[model samples]
Target: MAAKSATKSVEQGRNLRPFYANHTPEQLKEALRRMWLVRRFEEMAEESYIRGLTHGTMHLSIGQEASAVGICLELTDKDYITSTHRGHGHCIGKGAEVKYMFAEFFGKEEGYCRGRGGSMHIADPATGNLGANGIVGGGLPLATGAALAIKKRGSKDVAVCFFGDGANNEGAFHESLNIAAVWKLPVIYVCENNQYGMSVSTERSTAVKDVATRAAAYNMPGVIVDGNSIADVNEAMTAAMERARNGEGPTLIECKTYRTRGHSRSDRNRYRSKEEIESWKGKDPIPAFEDELMALGILTQADVEGVRAGVEKDIQDGFDFATKGTNPEPSSLLRGVYTTGDAA
Candidate 1:
């Protein structure tokens, strides 16, 4: 299997096409920029938390940039997405502005959630990001429902659900997939298997060797891709989106990836070895993608450096916006707590 994969890689390199053949150079560059943004946003979020600028805990997707950007590359603002707790990347990939995201993190009223929902719950309706859930496997049913709604409305739009490996064992995962398959719902289930679920390794928790294999029971296509490779992820998502648009039910995609950071702010890095972390860092999605682009002559070193510089400015600007933004008023605490008007 390893030899076959090597051979395929060699062939792909020889044939090298832009991630999506039709994608323009600018679009490809934008994808790279988004990946960098996701990484930088998380880094800044962590720095802010350490500096006592933010109070609540947050999950970071620093090493998993390719999975988020690649999956969303094929989706438009009209398409929907349900994100997990570690969804900063998803928000950025779906086109949420970093300034608003930073504001939300800083608990400013100018946030996407009016400063109520912090890192784990940012939602932008304009971008079709239904919301990021704090509960485990929370987005599964939500995406399923969104896909059902799309079907009922007779629309070609599909809903993508991003969940972690831990969520795979949740009842919602099985229930949602079953219903989506039975009704031919246009939902794509993306499992970002970052090796460990919080601290527990999948080898110890999951019965199946690969999470995608579980989709077979639902009679849908199950695909596994190297989540570190943006092109690999984009190709898989493109196919899944195509299938969904063709009225061909839901598809399950498992991104074999790793997260370089600890699960949350409180984690002490006790469970995993330093060697494992270092190994994954070597496969860091941003540099890997940049290398691919350079190899293909899609971008020069100066172009890559320019993108990084632009991202640095964006991150700094977002930080400034968040810090200068107004805080949520204590007087309006109950504003969005309860639905006003006729409850009936």
Candidate 2:
């Protein structure tokens, strides 16, 4: 009787473990650090834009850090990802250095695109980041193509596509998902539904209550997760990635999140109420994750402070690097415009 009781207790404990228990303590700590980094980086970027230190507009993912970090935590360096306009968090989560990103934003010659592509077009091939697209639904087809290439090459790598909810209504979204499902291609489509596309709320634009329901038309699994919870996002992503890697075609995951900032720097934010913004602020991913880590004994208050301090230093250094870097010259404008080498 005692043996059976002990067995039941162990089973209960196993069932009670958090969704993120599969990850090591080190990985959890690193995730927390990256979340903080994403939050701080966007804050600094907004400051720089306000001070006229950077040109062009940028879409800041100030409140949607967990979705980015959680999804990328399940990916490897060999895996591919296509990003959207609001993709700074995705890039940082995929192992991009802040200094180079700053360089790109500042239009310095040492940037990822040699100062050609600004905030909306940052890409790092070394990290398997194809590029961030300025157009809505632009990355959907690209991710599908990349997944097709991986399938043909017989590689196990999968492609993850990050797009906003606005893209869901686009024709490309349907086409990409249909083809991906038909071919059994290894692609994961993640929709960061921040409730609004520009000034239009999802309620006003979307026909359905939840975007994930559309996945049924393509005959794929559709999932919904709280984008503010890193563990929840990670759990969903882990399952989706596993299915993709196992040659089970695509999965559509809609992360129901919110963006604290306006659509862009120029946005007046007249469409939403201040109360709504404050309510989402109370659900901020960073503080919630920090509390979770502390409860699990993976981190303490001092450790959290240390992480914040280190991230601050990194952001400052990146800003200094960008400010001190050289700008691009006009003479090299047409250098990479046309292909010069043989196709063969």
Candidate 3:
């Protein structure tokens, strides 16, 4: 009789290596950790909203972690990024402090906007995060202007604008792209194609199969990437960044991803079918990347768990900081609105 094996089957466990093979060990570890943080942070924001801890409407990026992290990884700290309303992932990727983000949502003194602009308006100018906008297609022009500034200053810095598929349908998208292309501005237009613009799917919204295809109109190269694959997204982003820095002008990258959560906290997401949501959920980026990394021998079960734990701790610390921080003074609220007073 043959003896039965005692070891656990690899099939029973997670494997996430291939997507991380191009990454150094530290980069792979940080990637895993950042994804975990983004997920956890979204959950926290959702919970806070439900508990009435956060003010204003909340938009959670539950399944769009890869697109944010992968693209932002290609940018330097000095580079700028304009984000959309559902931009927690982008804010985090661009190195915004989780604590300040939490404070921003809580409307506390420690918030990025000094308790003025809630979830959708989070920004850290010091980190080159211009701001996340409430209006669709609003940030596009701002990004173009920033690129112009970089050009005028003769700086190697680039500006990346993150927007939804809905924004592409706007005139600002077209106008900004045209001007940026004509001027050869250093900018990257990243369309986080979550297949939905609010409640409308891309099929119902746009006639084009790929949003990147529109880049051709402006004489720029447009590329489509599997937003679900962090590795591919990162590679595409790196190429785009290189093109921008070399003064070759902007590249339009449409990352085909899906958002599992509703458009906002009030949304029931009844517009989409359950089967559709399930289908997209199956292609979720985190687990998909885990499988790829394990295959490439870059991650093991323990590694994933450790990274998750670290993220949890950071999230908890952020919450603690937000809660412990003092609220801003009522009179001080009027300050910094228009001008800074001179001490003299």
Candidate 4:
């Protein structure tokens, strides 16, 4: 068992260079900027919610930024992705404009979905975002359908489904996997296993130590990576997406991450111990990746502070934009409810 574990470590070390070795210093800087944007955006959003500026329950992807950015860095604007309630990072990583996101959060007219979708339901067809679903495991079947649609159209566009460990227990997961493997659809199942399904711990719930092992039941490649390590996630996604784009069916990628915040604002997180939370905080993805960049000479302390200042300014601008924008007119509320025009 010791020898097997040592070999696995050596293989992981070799493949973890996909992001570090391939990208230019400039590219790394931009990637880091996006990660920072996600982190700051969530922080500000939480502040806004506390101040009662944004209504509705919002789930923050506070600690899982690396998984979102790494997988999305491999995607193009034409590729499709579905998200869960904790979906801000995924949307941001897929090139969503923070201005409109703020508008939606504020329920203003300028928002994505025209203030109807808010954070969880925001969808942008222009960017190939099918939309974020509020239901657990909802995106699984939808993503599979999208992959099938792309295959039928003979398009190279692939679909990615970003789900949580909670959804793994749902029937949709197994059903979707069976169909995707049988049809060889171009969809990637990304499980952001953050250890807890709301208040329930994984140890008391999950059947296996690694969710990736479940992929075997469907005859697809299963991969597990450190969700805190940006490079490792990118490397695994590179291989998985490569197989998908090449018409080799789907791959199940389990990113073993954690949620630093409560499952939602109402959650006190009484279910978890303080020691566990602090240990995960020590492994925070943002600072972890920043350290990696510093070691490679791609970033300095000054650069880090500068990036923070820039992101702060940008986030402030988004908040200002949302606060100043007009609320959705009551008369137009029913405008998009149904289509009255011809179908074809």
Candidate 5:
């Protein structure tokens, strides 16, 4: 384990170079396919919301696929992940069945949380997904507790907590990082810094130019990456995961990305400019990965189109299954909230 540090510059100087690991052509192809699927799923879900099919507001992960997929690919079945409100990308990357995720969004009984938890609270314990949290910074402590559990169980499993840059402003964020760092818990804190926490920009709230720099106070590795580049995202994630798996400690990774949509269901997003949005859009993860694959002669225009078609069909099937499923019974509303009669 690394010695604890109390200074910011030390942390910054430690891992100035981004981590990179070679991926086979097959693996790269699969990543591109999954990224495409996630983006399509987000678009379809948004359409459902606009069509009055979904009941609640949504937090889309449309433009931030790389960060979610990159970090999640490094996790194992025993390793846990706590997701954010914008959780679809993470859930997909963690291998949660897309059909069930869409079902949950549509409030079906077959959903991940049986339709009770809805979009924001979809969880699958079988896959080690703790669930997506609705409250800002809510999953920070939950993930920390999960890391503590891993320690008690004497396992090598690490907890990956995904949150936005805005979440760093929350007190729970700081508290959890402090505790995890102090105890040397196996947790990787991924801040998907989409530049904005809702409509509020990070610059408006934080004194630090980069959120990763804050990791110094806790004496952990902090890495910043180009969130739009899936390659860069995966490279950084590999290093952080390796560190945690080795019992070294937690890491704070800031992925600088942007969301193509508004803050929530209703925001018009008058705060941000079109030029900024377009600038980030040019760096979209899917296209970047596609370009790389094509450059390596791995993917052609036809292959890309085929992947898009398959993803569309898969998403449509999910929506169909969800809409056809029945809603939950009123009596079952209180289900899973409390433990039933089974004393130890």
Candidate 6:
């Protein structure tokens, strides 16, 4: 039987090469490794939350690894990205340290926010992650304002704002898009349409089936791609980033995927059925990619196991770092809050 990777794009016939044909073996390996890291990270986070290791309610992006990796891999570290509440994958994909992420989860002083912000407020400026927002559509204005600043400074840097399908309905989304469009700001609005928004399915709440359609109102390109297909998402992102960097304006990419976990710790998932969840589970991007790699002779069984072991070591190291790190001291809690004349 022919390998699936031997297949060509729908537009092209068998004459064209496979999707991974253009990518080096090393690149494919890293892609699979990165996706594995995200899956393991989310699973570990959920376990930590249940074990009372992480504070506050936790939102796990368990099934959405491909979407995050695909888009963020297209950008440079100098470019900025604003993230949503379920932003661990975004944060990690954008180059945030897993150790720091674990620190944040454990409320350690070494965390991105010194443990003050917790899960939703994770941000690392060094890596160009503006921050993750706890509020719905909260990061939209922040990302837009950052794009405005980049434009004002005449920098080629771009800003990517990651939001869910639910955030598209928010007022900030419309206002920010309008302003960004008027000025031709360098920003990419990525809507992670994972079927449901905290138990409220998009079919019932959204006006249009495709959230990309909303981009037309702002006079920009609106593209939709399979969120499960990393290559497809990357293709769309490459186009959007080109538009943003050329000062043409923003592009909204609608990535259709599913969130494997509940909305939060309190979620019972009474809204959805087991059959539907299992259907998505069967399409898990990580395993699918793995099988593709093996089928294409790009990865051996030993190579795959080595990657998994390496990822586990990294996760364990992060756990150890968080466990050994000092907790936030109450005395120094307010030190960074108020800016002093000499501090800046």
Q: Estimate each model's TM-score.
A: 0.94, 0.94, 0.92, 0.93, 0.91, 0.91
Q: Write the per-residue lDDT of candidate 2 for residues 1-344, one digit (tens) a residue.
A: 00012222212333435444566656777788899988998999999999999878999998899999999887777889999999999998988888889999999987887788888999998878998999999999999999999999999888999999999999999999999999999999999999999999999999998999999999999999999999888888878888898999999999999999999988998999999999999999999999988876667899999999999999999989988989877877786777784221
Per-residue CA lDDT of model 3 for 1-344, tens digit only, reads 00112232122233433334334656766776777788999899888878878767988888899999888876667889999999999988887779998988888889998788889899999879999999999999999999999999999889999999999999999999999999999999999999889988889999898999999999999999999888888888878877998999999999999899889977887899889888888988998877766766667888888888888899999998997877878868667766668221
lDDT of 6 by residue, 1-344 (tens): 01123233123432323345545566667767788888888888888987887778878888888888878876677788999999998987786778888898899989888888889999999878988998999999999998999999998888999999999989999999999999999999999999898989999989998999999999999999989888788778878877998999999999999987889988999999999999999888888878877876778999999999999999999988988988866767566676773232
Looking at model 1, residue 227 earns an lDDT score of 92
Q: How high is the lDDT of residue 51 in model 5?
A: 91
Ranking by lDDT: 1, 2, 4, 3, 6, 5
Greater TM-score among 1 and 6 belongs to: 1
Off by over 4 Å in 1: 1-14, 18-20, 341-344
lDDT of 2: 0.89
- TM-score, cand. 1 vs. native: 0.94
**Number of clashes recorded per candidate:** 0, 0, 11, 0, 0, 0
TM-score of 2: 0.94
For residue 207, model 5's alpha carbon misses the true position, in angstroms, by 1.1
Give candidate 6 misplaced runs (Cα > 4 Å).
1-23, 341-344
Provide C-alpha RMSD values for all models, in order: 5.3, 5.5, 7.5, 5.9, 6.8, 4.7
Worst 10 residues of 2 by lDDT: 1-10
What is candidate 4's lDDT per residue for 253-289, written digit by digit as tens?
A: 9999999999998999899999998999999999988
lDDT of each: 0.90, 0.89, 0.85, 0.87, 0.83, 0.84
Best by lDDT: 1
**Distance (Å) between predicted and true CA of 234, model 6?**
0.5
